[model samples]
Target chain A: MEPPRALLFDVFGTCVDWRSSIIREGEALGRRLGLGTVDWAAVADAWRALYQPQMETVRSGARPWVTLDVLHREALDRVLADAGLQGVPESDRADFTLAWHRLDPWPDTVAGLHRLGQRFVVAPNSNGHIALMVNLSKRAGLRWDAILGAELARAYKPQPEVYLRGVEALGLVPSQVMMVAAHNVDLVAAAACGLRTAFVPRPTEHGAGQTTDLRPARPVDVVATDLGDLAGQLGA
Target chain B: MEPPRALLFDVFGTCVDWRSSIIREGEALGRRLGLGTVDWAAVADAWRALYQPQMETVRSGARPWVTLDVLHREALDRVLADAGLQGVPESDRADFTLAWHRLDPWPDTVAGLHRLGQRFVVAPNSNGHIALMVNLSKRAGLRWDAILGAELARAYKPQPEVYLRGVEALGLVPSQVMMVAAHNVDLVAAAACGLRTAFVPRPTEHGAGQTTDLRPARPVDVVATDLGDLAGQLGA
Candidate 1:
């Protein structure tokens, strides 16, 4: 088979440890806001849990087209209130919302991506909108050749349109691009769309709370330990 | 006034020295094809002359949305035949068409963009489609934060939607995004859409046949000698 000309990555849990970053930031903000004994990690998880359902609302037409940032803000507000944090200032709320913009990259992310990018057109094909992903890249030093998102397709991920739209944007057939992700479901979705797939297991993506995706979940083209390992496997 | 948070640059004349690069490439290709006495520079100029008119065809609804690469290829074919070039094989035509993908940047472009990229989000707001711009960035060493193009808006540049679409893609307000270009008319259209504007004169963009845009034709927020000067002026 022809070597992949492009590598499309799943951004959130794959390249960046969003759960830990969000929890750490949330805990710090919670303490400053005088919230005692708050389960910031749990709150972070809960906020993330809302992600799919929230996008589903838009997907199902219960909501109009809203960016991931907006969805994140709405979810944060609800989660903060439910966690019993009250009367937070609007500026603080805005700051909390902007936390998504400052996500930290996984330990091997930058170096691995840099290596891989030397050979391939590497980019993020994520549920995150282009703006959010671009800001996150700048903040976290994630070197992406381009920022692509479901927002470009007006649809969320796990949908064929997302993968197809990304390939179309790159001016390549789906087969010419490879989708690399820690999530088996994402890789499966991409494989279904006729793109090459690589699974890089992030066993601790949920930080000891992880249960699913402990191993290669399907017949993906490649299975690596991490981004660095994936880079090596790809001969980058 | 609040400083512009993002700078959107026009690519062809403003960033890459397309005229000279195309002329050089065409001349080299002409020589390789044994087309002696062929005026490649004139052919290049003639091809470029077809740019605005072709885009105008699309803009005027006489043609559909065609990428700059496709338009360039079409123009190259016409100009080659009109210039009395002979024995240009089909394979050579494909090679000549790919020349646009390998444009050389002006001397200061890489350094200027590197410096400016340190301060603000920098991207190309060009008539080139996303794939073309992205490939060009990789080929020409343009350090763009993101690639924005007319393809995303399904329209050509100087159109309000193209300018506003770029701002929206960057997740910035019109006032927070500045359109930087060598052409006064481009800035005029951008300013009319409420975007901030910067002018960097590319006096010889039209080459030895150059006759206009030796300087800013209209008032804009910032005027500079070149990208390097613009970077210094912007404190980048």
Candidate 2:
């Protein structure tokens, strides 16, 4: 089959190396605070653990719509308190939460994106709001044909509206747009919405002992080792 | 005062020389149809003139929300019929309506956006939906830091929600983002929503004999000859 006209990415670990980057930034903040011996990676993992539940409130209509930045900030505060890493100033916490906006892409992301951009429109179908996506794109030099996804739907990923509206925004039917992610769940959701799907496993997204999504847990149209391999497979 | 961190543009006439671009494309289509001696320029103006009233129907709840593409398509059919350019093929008519997507940016647009990209986050806060804006950006090389506007707000410009939500998506207060446009009406509405405004006149946007918005009709934070001047004045 021919390739889709646009590729929408589930960005956190699919495009950007969120785990290591967040840990590195968290550790630096811990060092500056003299909060010795903090498990920065663990903090990063724990903080991400809160992502789904926090978004659930909004999805369930228990809360007004809030962007991922707000979700991340609130999650960080609670995670820090629970981990007994309190006393980090609100200003520092705010800055630390912004680490999501400064993630480093996998070494292959930039070059692969450049190649793929020649063929298809590339954008982050991220839960990250437009601002976070903008900052991340600017910092990482990931040239997107457009910025799109969740904020436009006023909902989080896996919501039908998010994937539906994502394809709609591209002025294409879902079948003409592919949702590429490192996670099977995201692919599952997108496929259910009638979009094409690709899974590029980020085995170490949660570090060396990562259990989930070590491989494509379910069927997808394309499965590659990394974005570079994906680009090659897609003929970009 | 410090320049805003983000600049949201009005796309139709501000960044793109839509009149010339549309006229050129329309005349080509006209010739293809063997409809000799058609005044394509007037058709372009008449089509654009329908933009406000079309959007106003949605604004006033006279119709359900329809995207700019749909609105343009509807308006194009009416404009063609009125001009006696009837019975155009469905596919050809659809492609013609997308002339907005193929608009040529003003000569200064690419260079000025590049300059401004060094400092402020640049985006098109246009009534144009994400796809049209995305196509325009790729075709014209207008680098946008983000895309936010009518589609997200479910309304067209001049609606306070458009400006308010546009700013909110950037995670900034309205005052921290400038709305740059060639139309005084746009700046007036943006200002009413607390956004900083810049007026850059495109006196020839409606073709020769156009008289409105020859100068700033309302006080704007900056008035520049074009985007390049705006970039220079804003120190980007």
Highest lDDT model number: 2
Question: What ranges in model 1 sit over 4 Å off?
Answer: none
**B180, model 2: CA deviation in Å?**
1.0
Count of backbone clashes, every candidate in sequence: 0, 0
For model 1, which pairs clash? none
Kindly report the docking quality category of candidate 2.
medium
Task: Tell me the docking grade of candidate 1.
Answer: medium
Report the lDDT of model 1 for residue A205. 77
Q: Which one is best on DockQ?
A: 2
Whole-model Cα lDDT of every candidate shown, in order:
0.86, 0.90
The stretch of ten residues in a row with the least summed lDDT in candidate 1 chain B is B208-217
lDDT of 2: 0.90
RMSD of 2: 1.6
DockQ (model 2, Cα):
0.70
